[model samples]
Target: MIKTIAAWIGSYADHPDPRSALAGKIALVVASNQPFYPLYLHWIVGTAAWPAWLSLLSTPFFLAVPALARRHSFAGRALLPLAGVGNTVFCVKLFGAASGVELFLLPCALLGTVLFRPDERLKSAIVAALPFIAYLFVDAHLGEPVMMTSDYARLVALNGMSVAALIALIGLLCSTQLATREVEIVTTEIPGARQHVDISD
Candidate 1:
């Protein structure tokens, strides 16, 4: 089954197929949200409303899929989610950890693993680490960790689910374009624009 899907996804090369790119981005969004599912459960049982910030980290990944599907900016698909991860790390300090804060590292690592090529992986590792590293510095400066207390069941469930999701994500990513080919991104101009003319002539 794995081999079949792997062949279907295609061999990696200097560039990604548009379909494979779309699948990769969608997979990212799916993998990114695994942490949030349990967090949402915590909110539902613990609060009257879902906190908007809980959705913060994965939103860009979700939003970027259409553009990626359309074969838009490679940087947008590849880099924007890193910003979201960084934002989430900072958010953990400002908010509380019960939103499955630590679990984000799983997705961040998984994201880097799939989105980056062999040559790019080192830089991708650094970029992926920067936010958490920055947060550590900020956290040390600020003081100790902030804990958000949740029910024992919720905590256990969140942790368990996070681990399972991480494993599944790793498995899924093994079939992605990164595993099959090198990538070369093509930049395309927007469909419409004003062209200059010598109207005075």
Candidate 2:
């Protein structure tokens, strides 16, 4: 069943790197969106504590993941910072402190390197990390609980989403850096010079 499912999904996941990246994006989107379903169920049943808009507004950030996987420069460049800031703020607001949900900021920050080309990585990385960096500078010390309504169940759900998102991004990072060049090695006339190895698609 596993192999069969892999084969089936392999059609959409064309290349190895993209396959991994796509998996990560899908996992992020699913994880971010997952709570909405349950929350909506409770909302319908009139038992939800959290407002629906809190999660609803975050949809665009996750939705950008697919475009990033497609190598859309705008999406890759814009999304990391957006998600990082939005999620980090939400974490502090919802839990009234530095909750573990803020952990996803690291992976989102690293996406600057993983998702973009060399030319864009630095700028992307700076943007991705700036929000968290600014937060550290402004609110260096913890304040009194702001939204003290967070419960154990909510914490578990938020942490679980962060873990799942991190695992997916890690998988993307590890999926056999498809050699951008051939396997053969050659000598160069210049001392300490590296030979350029040609790669095929």
Candidate 3:
């Protein structure tokens, strides 16, 4: 099942540049995993409400990421972080400041850093900046939560765990991509260098 999902993500990562292709794959992975969040919140955590159900409305936008990547890698990369910002903001509004959903902005910012090519510094900066802007906006404007919870600590704890899990997942994927690129670079620059790589570690 994991191999199947990885292959599906790879199909959309056909950009000419390795970095861009990896960016698209990262977007695709995030897109594919999004639909499960509401489920986890509603069923597993039991902290979701009707407003939380509305969060699913954003799933289609995320699902469109691969198609966008197919047409324009940069657009797809841009969309993922932008959409994540919107989604996180909306969720924070739904659950309020105490729910800790706003913590997701960290990963959204991290995505923007790796999704764009090094030469596209301006675009990456703009994308990355949106989260901070949204964070401030959310902090200042959040008046009342759409869904109120009796146990603020539980919601905060749950969201903290969720955010931590997401960060770890994204970090692992980004690190794996970096490792693969290093190997590719070494082999390409020096023929037969691939044989020196140890696989039994």
Candidate 4:
């Protein structure tokens, strides 16, 4: 079932370039994760937290990443980080700094790094910097909690662990891509070396 779901998600990332494909997959995965925030909010504060459920408004924009990419790859790539920053900012406003929702900016920054090709230095820098800038702005200027919750400790831990898990998942994807590239490079550099070493036998 997990494999099936992964394959389904990967279908949207059907670009020839491995990096672009990776970016597409990342965009879809991150976007798909957003709707769950309302569920988490409901769990933490019960079902009556209607105002907090407003975070779900960002899901469509996130889901639009792939559709926009199909029209223009740059648009899709650009939207991922932008949508992320927007979503995170809205979340920070809804829950405030104490909820640790701002920690999500870390992954948003990381997304910017991996989403763009190496040639797009300016775009990458802008996308990556947006998250850091938002974090600073939020930390400094955020006034009060829009949605009050007594469970500060739980919210902090939840957001922290959630961010950590996302980072780990992204790290695994990056490491896997790197390893695959390395293997391809080695295989290309070697001439008939595999034929001489029949490890399969």
- Top TM-score hit: 4
Writing each residue's lDDT as its tens digit, candidate 3 over 128-166 gives 899999998656596787887666777678778877877
TM-score of each: 0.54, 0.55, 0.82, 0.84
Rank by TM-score, descending? 4, 3, 2, 1
Q: Which TM-score value belongs to model 4?
A: 0.84
* C-alpha lDDT values of all predictions: 0.50, 0.52, 0.75, 0.78
For model 4, residues 87-123, the per-residue Cα lDDT tens digits are 8898887888888888888988988888778788775
lDDT of 3: 0.75
lDDT of 2 at 179: 35
For candidate 3, the per-residue lDDT at 100 reads 79
Question: What overall lDDT, based on C-alpha atoms, would model 2 receive against the true structure?
Answer: 0.52
lDDT of 2 by residue, 109-132 (tens): 555455555676566666756666
Clash counts per candidate, in order, are: 8, 0, 0, 0
Q: What is the C-alpha RMSD of each candidate to the true structure, in Å?
A: 13.7, 7.6, 3.2, 2.9
Task: Assess the local accuracy of residue 179 in candidate 4 as a C-alpha lDDT between 0 and 100.
Answer: 93
Question: Residue 181 of candidate 1: its Cα lDDT?
Answer: 35
